[model samples]
Target: MAEVSAEARIEAPAEKVWAQLTDFTAYGEWNATHTSFPNGGPDTLETGATFVENMKLMGFPAEVTWTVEELETTRVLAIRGKGPMGVNVGTRYALAADGAATTVRIDGEFTGAAVSLMAGKLKDSATAALNESLRKLAGLVT
Candidate 1:
């Protein structure tokens, strides 16, 4: 299995950050990596909720069916999904209060053939994308 994690501290309250992050319908508004996410909208965020997300990764269009695996009000959200790559991918978002800011962390992992062949490259790309998304989220919340 290959794992990739990235974190950022935003100058915003945890509630504000959580609201923006969990609002699935508006993901395309600030998430640079997502081109379109026309699935269950914001209502499809509870545990076991399923949706399809269309994203551009490394300039390629990729679509994945994702299910919310876990959710905790303003602290954590985790999603798991699979695509044609045959990998079970897990994406997690964690939030913590830091003084007057909110620290957000994103972690992802791939457990299948596609990631084993390109683990290093995938890790690098995931890190960069996570950082970019954090920057955009910060801008949106602040």
Candidate 2:
């Protein structure tokens, strides 16, 4: 298994940050790993809601089937998914409101036979992607 996390403090309220985070239509503009959402971002982001997303990791394109496992408006959102080669992936976005700013943390994990083979490199790539994503997200909202 491989785990990666990144965080940023954005100069915007949690409401504004959450609004941009949940807006699938604008995701590609800020999300580093997101290449496209073939079925479009979920219309309703709730538990059990499922969607397919096209992504690029380590320069390889992959299709991931994701299900929303948890959602709390302006606070938290988590998703678990399956990708190629029997890989299992989980991602969690947590937000904390401090006065007028929002602190966002992204946590990601991967577990599978394939993941074990490239865990180190995957961790490095994912960490960088998460950091870049947070930077872009901050730019968009703040």
Candidate 3:
């Protein structure tokens, strides 16, 4: 299994950051690994809702079918998915309000036979992607 995480502080309130984060239609604009949502983003932001996303990581393209596992307006969003080669992927976006600004953290995990073979490289790539994604997200709201 491979796990990666990144955190950043944005010069905007939690609500502002949450708005941009949940705006799935604009997801690829800032999410580094995102390619596109083939059938469009999820129609609802509730637990159990599912969506399909196309993404690129480690120079390879993949399609994932994701189910929302958790949701809390302006605070958290978590999803788990099945990716190519039977890889299981999980991601969580958490937000904390701090006065006039907000701190955001993204945590991701990968597990499956394929991951065991390239865990190190996957960790490095995923960590970088998360950081880049956070930077772009901050740019949009801050």
Candidate 4:
């Protein structure tokens, strides 16, 4: 299993950050891992919602069917999905508010038979992607 996380402090309120973070229409613009949602982003972000997403990881394009695991309007959104080669992936977006700024954190996990083969490379690349995603999210909301 491999786990990675990245964080950023955005000069904006949690409401603003969460709004952009969950904005499906503009998700591809700031979401590094997302290439496209074939049917479009989820109509709703509530728990139990499912969506199919096209993504690039480890230099390969994959289609993942994800289910919303958790949701808190301005606090957190987490999803779990199955990826290519029987890999189980989970990602969480966490938001913390302090005065006028929001602290955003992205957490990722990969598990299953395939993850052991390239854990190191996956960790490195995933960390970079998480950081880059945070940067893009910050740019959009702040």
**Candidate 4: segments with Cα more than 4 A from true spot:** none
Q: Weakest 10 consecutive residues, lDDT, candidate 4?
A: 56-65
Task: Let me know the TM-score candidate 3 reaches against the reference structure.
Answer: 0.99
lDDT of model 2 at residue 10?
97
lDDT of 1 at 51: 82
lDDT of 2 by residue, 20-123 (tens): 99999999989999999998988789999999999999999999999999999999999999999999999999999989999999999999999999999999
lDDT of 1 by residue, 17-101 (tens): 9999988777877776787766555364689988888877667677888888999999999999886678787999999999889
Ranking by lDDT: 3, 2, 4, 1
Clash totals for all models, in order?
A: 0, 0, 0, 0
- Could you give the C-alpha RMSD of every candidate to the true structure, in order shown? 1.4, 0.5, 0.5, 0.7
Pairs that collide in candidate 1 are none
Candidates 2 and 4 compared by lDDT, better number: 2
CA lDDT of each candidate? 0.84, 0.96, 0.97, 0.92
lDDT of 1 at 6: 83
- What is residue 123's positional error in candidate 3, in angstroms? 0.3
